[model samples]
Target chain A: MTEATHSAPAPSPSGFRLDRSSWAWVGVAPFLLFAVLFLIAPTFFLIIGAFQDADGHFTFRNISNLFQPSIIASYWISIQISAASAITGAIIGFFMAYAVVLGGLPRWLRPTLMTFSGVASNFAGLPLAFAFLATLGRTGLVTVFLVKWFDFNPYAHGFNLLSFWGLTITYLYFQIPLMVLILTPALDGLKKEWREASSILGASPWQYWRYVALPILWPSLLGTTLLLFANSFGAIATAYGLTGSSLNIVTILLYAQIRGDVLHDQNLGYALALGMILITGLSNGGYIWLRARSERWLR
Target chain B: MKTSKIGPWIAFTLGALYFIIPLIATFEFSLRLKRGEYSFEAYRIVLGDPRFQATFGYSTLLALATIVIGVLLVVPTAYWIQLRLPKLRPVVEFITLLPLVIPAIVLVFGYLKMYNSSSLLPLTSSPWSTNLLLTFGYVTLALPYMYRAVDTGLRAIDVRTLTEAAESLGAKWPTILFKVILPNVRSALLSGAFLTFAIVIGEFTMAALLDRPAFGPYLQLIGANRAYEPSALAIIAFFVTWACMGLIQVFGRGARGASPETR
Candidate 1:
């Protein structure tokens, strides 16, 4: 493709070569302009606002304000949920991906799993919350089934669908599938020769995985876990739809803050957004770095 | 030694159950809206609600507008990057991936602060401008997916040769882009469009914060206020997402089969 483009007929004469080359930048100007105006500028404004006072004076008060108990508690809860969901999602999704790709399952199951994963990963936000509620809420089908058939009530046993654990389980609905979708290809990248070679060296299956496969796959595993963390960390819709404001996740807090200025300080809101950006940004950056490392082996 | 299938089967079964039960429960619950009988009464009420119609229609239009703007922005830029400015690939890709790093709530918060009624742009000053801002936000959210699909599509075709051939035939850039490149990537465009529709249709945060009467906000409102109706809406939303993914698969398969270069 590069050779073809390099050898293509030059539209401009040699005298106008510079002009034509400069004109090429015009083709991308609109895109760059749009990215700057909407994507970069808005976020940049918030990041800058986070460090400013209401009177437009530079101050660290907003950042310091985030250290208060309520704000810190919200961030802590958000981190816990994101980490819990991401870790569990990765484990279950890895098993599922392994089952379909390397578990010697029937051939038809792979496409079915892939297709379902594609749907479920995108099948997030509000409807996902409703689905889980209909499944596990007090009068839900599963709850009723467990009570009628097994003589047990989840509510009586301290299972609440609007709590932290409930939200994690609901999030796994999408997270696990996303894990499956992403990890399948990584699993497929496991060369058959390695397994055969390991076996010929008298290594057991577990030994092979622990010594050979795990080393190559850990970066991807960890990276995707981080990706999932960032994914749920930034998500508001599912949490909002499930627990409403009762959950006190950072996202819900931010949502309420945005809706009514519950924080009563505009700069504090910017600091809240800045904190979210920092967390998601760091996790995503780690994911990218680890993904790059894994790609070297997988490729 | 033959590996035992027990572990894989168990894993698959457990995974399948986890995914399927919620859907089954939602469907069953959606049906139980009426007293002592299974009926589509909830569906009827939801489908017949004037607010539902208005919001769904509004979101559909917004989704279409997002698709159009997204395609217009992404296709040319992707094509240009492939054909002219390959060096800018990394920069463009990084920008596209920024949306994933920055949450929608934060992005919308930024927009409110930057484009508020008192700000320079003041996009939130009017309903029309707010809708435009909302659409632009959707476009930003959909950028990573749309760009990837179109870029992959462009890669499947011989862009340089096609452009040269069109140039020799005295066709202008727009002619070559629309008449030549676009048709070759129709399936990709459709796949991206459907995915965008699925995303923008029931998107809750941006529209809710932007105060647009989108279907997502409507779903949340109904979920907050009503019981059985929310379940019904969940079923409907699932069906929409399923249909979108199914169509993407269909077109995606078609693209793979039809493109001689791929095979």
Candidate 2:
């Protein structure tokens, strides 16, 4: 597809050559204008605002203010939850994808899993939070069933569906499905010949995974884990809907700051957004770079 | 082989249980709003509520507008890139992926700052303009998926040959684009539109922070106060998302079957 597009024949020498080139650009002008006004400009404004003080003088104070204990704690908690969910989601989703793709399962299950993953991955935000709450809240169906059938209550066992762990669990609902969706293709990239050759050469399954499969899959695995981390790190709605103001995740803190200027510094909110962009940006950059690396082998 | 299949069955079973149990639980809880028996009382109240009607209707309209605007903006650029300036593909794709790198909250924060009432553009100066800004924000959010879908669609068809064929027939640019190129990618456009609908319907951050009375904020509001209605809303939202994905699959399959090149 790319080759066909790139290989468009150059127009024969004619007076209309210049006109045609310019007109082609005109076709994309409206899209470029919309992107500038809405996407690029607003983000650049915040990036610039993050460096400016109230008086419009440039200062590093906003960035420095991020180190304050409460702010640091919020970022730390956000990172922890994101990391926890990403790692757990990666592991569980890998197993599930493996089960569907390579576990000798029925052929019908692949499309079913893919379609479910599509729905589940997009089935996020406030409604996702509500779903988890209805499933695990104090009077939830699962909670009541556990009490009645198993003689135990998660709440009595010190499990609350409104804490750091609670938030991680909720995040995994989407994270796992996203992992399954992305990693399935990478798993498909693993040629069966390599596994068959390894097995015929008397390598054990564990050895094949450790020596060959793991090395081949490492970049995608780690890169996707980073992607998942970024995915949850920047999310606010689910955490906000699940825990409200009780949990001090960075996103919730920024939400509060955005709503009421709780930090008493508008620039600091820009700084908060800057901090989020930097983290998600770096992880996504890593994901893209490692994806390029993996593509070399996969292709 | 039997042992290997057992492991897969267990994994598949656990995954299915994890995914499905929540829906079952939410549905059960939604039905329990009337106290004694399973009933659609929560769905009834939620469906009948004026606020629910208003917010859901508002979001549906916004989602439709976002789809139309997104399609209008994406299709031309993608087609132009594929047909004319293939060199700009990387730059355009990078820009589309920017939203994923930057969170929606951060993007909306940027919009709030850049287009505030005091700003020169003053997009938020009026309800109409603010809604416009909100719609644009959604277009930005959905840009990545929309562009990828349309670009893939454009690629599947023989864009160069189709363009030349239409040109030889004396079809102008607009006619060639609309009549010749678009119908070839109808399924792709529908798939992208439905995905955008799923995304914008219950979106929380942009709608909430923008102070729009869309369904996302409505869901958050109800979740904060009401109990069972939120569950009912979640069920409904899930169905909407399911419908969108199902339609995409349906249209996507149709396109594959219709286009010999796709196979």
RMSD of each: 3.0, 3.2
DockQ of 2: 0.60
Residue-wise C-alpha lDDT for candidate 2, range B205-252, written one tens digit per residue: 998888889999999999999989999999999999999999999989
Residue pairs that clash (backbone atoms under 3 angstroms), model 1: none
- lDDT at position A211, candidate 1: 99
Docking class of 1: medium
Question: In every candidate, how many clashes are there?
Answer: 0, 0
lDDT of 2 by residue, A1-299 (tens): 22222222343323335556655566677888888999899989999999999999999999999999999999999999999999999999999999999999999999999999999999999999999999999989899999999999999989999998899989999999999999998999989899889989998889989999989898999999999999999999899899998999999999999899999999999999999999999999999999988887787
List, residue by residue over A138-197, the lDDT tens digit for candidate 1: 989999999999999989988899998999999999999999988998998999999999
Q: Could you say which candidate leads in lDDT? A: 1
Report the C-alpha displacement of residue A105, candidate 1, in angstroms.
Answer: 1.1
Model 1 chain A worst lDDT window (10 residues): A1-10
Lowest-sum lDDT 10-residue window in model 1 chain B? B254-263
The best candidate by DockQ is 1
Best by TM-score: 1
| Model 1, TM vs. native | 0.96
Residue B33, candidate 2: Cα error in Å is 1.0
